[model samples]
Target: MTLEIVVHRPSVSGGGRRVTVGGVDFGLARGDGDLVEFLRRAGLDDADQLVSGDSPIIQWRGGRAHEYGAAGG
Candidate 1:
């Protein structure tokens, strides 16, 4: 089964992007580290690689990888 991971736009408050797996909300991630943990918990052992590189499994919305601009930005 393909995991539909979506990194939503960063929030204006804390600049944390919401992460969802297969349409399930995994909470907000402030950075790649938070995203990696969420992915690992979701059973993706290669979470590190997946979060680091450009992988189609992850559909980033609003912003690209690691581009969570400052809340003031």
Candidate 2:
């Protein structure tokens, strides 16, 4: 199945990135750990595999992987 998960740009306040799966908002994630958990809770058992590299399942907007700091935004 193809899932469109978007990790939106980090806010200037540095709260965290907003995670959305298939247009539904899950929550904010500060790091990969939270991202993995959110994906798992969303019914993806292979969340780990999808969270790394250029999986094409995730659209990292306004930043790339490993970048979620407010100071950089």
lDDT of 2 at 33: 87
lDDT of 1 by residue, 31-55 (tens): 8999999999899999999988878
Candidate lDDT (C-alpha), each: 0.86, 0.85
Candidate 1 regions off by >4 Å? 70-72
Model 1 deviation from the true structure expressed as Cα RMSD, one decimal place: 1.7
lDDT of 2 by residue, 1-73 (tens): 6878899998789988999998889999999989999899889899988886557878889986757788485
Number of the top candidate by lDDT? Answer: 1
**Runs off by more than 4 Å, candidate 2:** 71-73
Among residues 3 or more apart in sequence or in different chains, the pairs in candidate 1 whose N, CA or C atoms overlap within 3 Å are none
How displaced is residue 50 in candidate 1, in Å? Answer: 0.5
All-Cα superposition RMSD per candidate: 1.7, 1.5
